[model samples]
Target: MHLSFKNLFFTIASVFGIFAILILAKPVLIPLAFAFLVAFILFPVCQKFEAWGANKIFAAFLSMLSLFLIIAGGLFLFSTQIIDLSENLTEFKEKILEIFTDLTLFINQNFSFVPELERGELLEKIKSGLSNSVGTLVGQTFSGTAAFFTGLITSIVFTFLILIYRDGLVNALVQFFPENHQDKAHKMFKSVQQVGQQYLFGMFIIVLVLGFTNSIGLLIIGIDNPFLFGFLAAILAIIPYAGTLIGAAIPVLYAFMSYDSLWMPISIALFFWVVQFFESNLLTPKIVGGNLKVNAFTSILSIIVGASVWGVAGMILFLPFSAMLKVVCQEYIELKPLALLIGEKNYTDSEKDDKPGLLKKWGEKIKGWF
Candidate 1:
């Protein structure tokens, strides 16, 4: 294909235009995006039930029921710790005041001069600011939580619809391509579904393992609410790269504030470091790495773009979607370069042929059927 100024202008316009639409339509699109991803994960389960002679409605309901139960059980388990934590809000407030007071004193003694009355006024202002911010944050949190559940409900409904009509939905998508290429499009969709299933299932296992190990480590170090913090960290680990560090920071700082000894914080930090090291080096690379087959740059770029478009939700969803995008792109001549740009580099075709990931095996089966 020849690169032309008009074509370049159109491409740039299309890119920006799509982003504008994504931003404007986010309230609906975000939930729809999530629903599609969840549908992909649950579709195989639906199929399994159908294979066992269950009706599509029953199969979809069963899948959704299982998910709802898992979520409810998790929330139930966390409720006790949440209540305990809520009871300590007074202590947390005091800790914040103490920290602020210490900072003010340090500034007065070491960095600047302040009259006694001025110092008191400054401290009062700081406290008042924090109080207002905290109140605003609390309100925002409640509203955000409500919005989340609403979206979740919407996603569940969409997933059920997608599950029951998966064949028609897929056929609709495949119809977008030319008639001659529709068969290839169908195979690509199969690969996309296969990748989604593998990635999600592998991530579930990784999170459980990480949560168990983190809790055990924290328990050994005598951190309060070890399981709660451990699993919270594990869930945040879904964010990729910096997520582990961000997740670990909460409990480690809490440890510093809660324990009189310095070693408690040190131990919490150390535990997370070890877990992160192993997870980065071993778990992810071994488990879900093959599912994406994307290079570091593309994955990171997708995360950044996703975050910019949809905040944290984008960061979590975009990576796998990029992988799926790559699968579809590889089938089209015009977009194959995009696939090459995102995909892992293999020096030789022989090297790629030598090792087939699970996704490749499934994709091969899909292609075989066509």
Candidate 2:
């Protein structure tokens, strides 16, 4: 047996084993991943502080302080929005009940197999869902307040430690490579830092822009609570494709019920479509760049896999992490094929039979032998 094949099989098994370990150690690793992202974003700022003669610990402390303030401010705004929205619970309930009733009626009218639901029973279900959803999300997902705080504090501490030991971390990673490959390993880490900063900071800018645009559009369309819905949608866009759809769907629904004419809903839908189009092609392209380097299919697949492994954290972290993996792969001759697999570059027919394509021909040859 060729040594190369043995190495390939060992590497594949190692990857599967690592995945199992990740799932088993998720409670610890998830926070660490979050910390790494935070440290990446804060790296430059920490450097400046260090350059000014601040100790690593103090530099990390200052950086973490600013991050905390920004997060607290955002949360405060969200809390206020929720509070104000709660004041309109009665109106929201009526609107929800109306939509539910009409939906049930349509279903019954369209489907012969469906039993018709009375309006009273339909309203009861809708009300129950609305009341329980908030509790379920906040309580069940976080598994109570203690777990949420633990993760938050853990991430913060990890970020500080990462920022403080940023250089040490890089050196530690480089040590894993042979002497001849040490330079490439260092370059890979540098590229990952650049990717992380570009991806995360660009996302922040895009979110702010989307929030403002969504709010202005909703205001023009005369939707109630435009700011609340707009920013909420904008924030949701952080979740990628599904978030944007869900965000727009909320206002579209509100517009459907708020106005007498169908034009209002149509207008809101069209507005989001245009905004999202420009966001993808213009805003994201300009700000985020091709840092992720993966295609849409890979991205959506990562989200599914990430959600399976890490839940919400996976969906948010996996895309960037995949890009990081690609960077690391590109640094190694043996791993370059894996990098190509991870990337989204279009290939000509001639390129299709490249090194990795050997596996395809090998499979076909096996069939001939069979």
lDDT (Cα, tens digit) per residue for candidate 2, span 1-370: 5578887899999989988998999989999999999888788778777788999899889888888899889878778767876887778769878877888777887884557667778778877887889877877776756876999899988998898788898999899989998997788788888667667777778899999999998898887778888988898898878889999998888777667889989988999999999988777755554435566777898889899999988988898888788877887788898777787653324332223222223334643332
Instruction: Report the C-alpha lDDT of model 1 over 105-134, residue by residue, as the tens digit.
Output: 878877667656354676688888888899
Q: Candidate 1: where is the Cα deviation over 4 Å?
A: 113-123, 132-135, 346-370
Every candidate's lDDT: 0.82, 0.80
Off by over 4 Å in 2: 1-8, 75-80, 105-118, 121-145, 257-259, 347-370
Clashing pairs in 1: none
Displacement of residue 115 (Cα, Å) in model 1 is 4.1
